[model samples]
Target: MKIICTKSNLAKGVSIVSKAVPSKTTMPILECILIDATTDVIKLTANDMELGIETRIEGEIIDRGIIALNAKIFSEIVRKLPDNEIVIETDMNNQTMITCEKAKFNIAAQSGEDFSYLPVIEKEDNIAVSEFTLKEVIRQTIFSIADNDTNKMMTGELFEIDENVLKVVSLDGHRISIRKIELSDSYGQRKVIVPGKTLQEISKIIGGEAEASVEISFTKNHIVFEFDQTLVVSRLIEGDYFKIDQMLSSDYETKVRINKRELLDCIDRATLLIKEGEKKPIIINIGDESMKLQIKSQIGSMDEEILITKEGKDLLIGFNPKFLIDALRVIDDEEVDLYFMNAKAPCFIKDEQQSYIYLILPVNFNAVA
Candidate 1:
């Protein structure tokens, strides 16, 4: 295959497709990126079995052919190439030549026939969301996704669409994050568990521009995301996600309204006294007019007070500093409402519209010695 394209375009194409390339795999073909230039547009694809990405770049296709090249090497070469036109050609001997202004390199290429292709997902069940809104939802909840894959469902986010409302939910064992948005057009009812890796990568591919949109389609076992001349197909985590709604409760004995920034800064400062590997709980004592925070660790202890508007009964609670900080950091509002049923029950943080809800389980008061 032979294609001539600008260095920046080629670099971007490589970067997008490279997200699916396995760093190391027993199947050597999975480490290579398939370049197809059979038509006027040049297409690049990579699949690591679980996640696959394909994108097209505008270029002049001199020879109608296809080849597979090492993703790492090709990406590095394209990235370092000068800001000039790039010419890529493959020969009969399966050797790939890459040329730029003053840099030229030749590498052995693999047969494109051996590379895996992204599975075709039917468009029967699909939803279109503005790229900006989708990105925002993912960002607000992605952090709550479990890092460890032990619980497959927790490692992914739940996309539940009912009528015109799109609800995205993610949670580790400690906390749950939910974001709700209303779509301009109703897309019917659907539910899918999307892998965090897929959403994270798609977030990077999508620009923050509010106008553009992404069309997402789902199959029985896979999900496809199409946006900006790119397509991503990923395997969905099997099984039903946890019923998180039951865990949220409006029965709170204490409700406090505080500035989001002030609470975040207080928890962040308290974390400083905590040593690495220490699971110290940040104790919060809520009163009628102010909330006090206390953290004790081997390094030291910290105490800070922030004024708050309180309703209901006064309460004292303890929580993992990181949990509160995580939820607080994502909130865009100037002030936040926090609800607590008791010292032992989970603490809830959300806005007035209930567009976002963050539930964090409090630690035992005795746990923080």
Candidate 2:
């Protein structure tokens, strides 16, 4: 294979496909990226069995062929190449040569036949979403996915699509995050559990183009994402997602409307005195038109008050500062409503439209210092 492409374009293509290359795998071919040169387009592909990524870059194809190169070394070399066009070729001896301006390097190449092919999804069942909106939805709920959980399904998010409305949900035992959006076009009804790691990588690839759209398709066991010049396929976790709607209740003994940033800042400051791994609870005493936040730890204590517009009965609740901070940080709203039923039930934080709902289980004050 012989191809010539600009340094920036080559680097970008390599970066996108490298996410699928496994850092440690028994199959050596899985660590290498397959570079295929056709008549006018140069394609790069990487697959780790479960997740696969393929992208094409516009380049001058001198020789139409294919070769596999070490992704780690190839990416580093392309990233540091001189600000000039890069020429890559594989000789008969199976050695890959890279040249850009004055720099040159030779590395052993592997046969592209050894690399596994990416899964191909039939496009009959597909949905379209704005790139910016999908990125935002993933960002808003991905954090709530359980990390290293024994129940593998909890480590992923639920993509529940009904007609034109799409709802994304993630929960980690302690809190549940749900974000719903209405799509411009409908793809009927579908539900799938997408791994959190896959969404994390997809979010990175999506640039800040709000108008650009992503085409998504789901099969029996895998989900496919296509946008721009890239394609991603990820295996879906098999299990029924928890019925989260029943858990989110509108019953509340107290409702307070407060500034999201102000509450976030107060909880963040209170956590300063708490040490790592310590289960410190930020006690919130909600009163009429105002609330006081306090945290007590072995190092010291912190207390602050923020004014709010309160209704119903007064309540005092304790919660993990990190949980509250996580929800508040992602919210783009200026004012938010916090609903509570005494101090035992979960607290709900959401906007007026209820487009995004965060239900956090309060910390048991009896167990904290």
Question: Global lDDT of each model?
Answer: 0.91, 0.91
Collision pairs in model 2: none
- Residue 77, candidate 2: alpha-carbon lDDT: 94
User: Tens digits of per-residue lDDT for model 1 on 18-82?
Assistant: 99998789998999999998777789999999999999998898898999999998898988889
* Candidates' RMSD to native: 1.0, 1.0
Instruction: Give the Å error, residue 301, model 1.
Output: 1.2
Clashing pairs in 1: none
